[model samples]
Target: MRKIPRWLARAPIPVFRLGIGGLLTKRLVMIEHRGRTSGLIREVVLETIKIDGDDVYVISGYGWSSQWLRNVKADPRVRMWSGWGRGVGALATILPRAEGLAVLDDYRTRHPGTVRALATGLEIEGFTVDGPLPEDITERMPLVRIRPRR
Candidate 1:
């Protein structure tokens, strides 16, 4: 995918910080994590893949290279905000390969337009928005499930 301008990418952060992200909460979520090295708290707005009960799933199209993904791996603990929710404690689970593929499958089945647009942006070889998803998709674009801590 073409790189997004840094300014455009960071535009939503201020919205979240100002506490108005709920307007798009059904489609987006804001997650806060401790930096792996800096140990400072960082926030990012990510697209919501699915919301099943207390589990909220999202995919890192940038894959493991995404700084947030790397940091989350270092520490599974995180805080997230969605509709009518703010700073809700949660745990980040990197979905297994098979499960990631399954989630992508279901997501595509449910939202073809969104998946098609996302797949177009992803530009991963053998990973189509419609056709059978590649088995290695998880490694290329990791899917994560964030569940509120009980």
Candidate 2:
């Protein structure tokens, strides 16, 4: 799979921020978090893997190196907008590797096409649309579970 350039990947951020993201809410979500160093609000759009009750799950294709992931780690407080609903106060938690793997397994079964695209975009090797993900791939991708603060 071809990887999108960083600039190209960020091009739709504004649209996502302006509530247009609601249209793609089933597959995409808008996250508003504070920059760890700058302490300024920053927003990023990411693919939503699953939603259980109030817990929303997303995978970091760029892993821990992702700036948004790092910011969320520094401060879990955030705002999330998705098709189901929008929350002004949410908490972001990095799931353990095992839990992340479980989520990946379920996501793969539920959204094979999207999972395949994600694997290709992230350049994860040994990924197949019909099989379980390898340990290496799971280890490289971190899963984030976000829920309303209340």
What clash count does candidate 2 reach? 0
Expressed as tens digits, the lDDT of each residue in 40-125 for candidate 2 is 99888787889898788998877777899999999999998776434468999999878988888888888788767766776767
TM-score of 2: 0.84
Question: What is the C-alpha local distance difference test score of candidate 2?
Answer: 0.79
Pairing residues by index, what is the TM-score of model 1? Answer: 0.92
Q: What is each predicted model's overall lDDT from 0 to 1?
A: 0.84, 0.79
lDDT for residue 99 in candidate 1, whole number 0-100: 91
- Candidate number achieving the greatest lDDT relative to the actual structure: 1
How displaced is residue 92 in candidate 1, in Å? Answer: 0.3
State every prediction's TM-score relative to the real structure: 0.92, 0.84
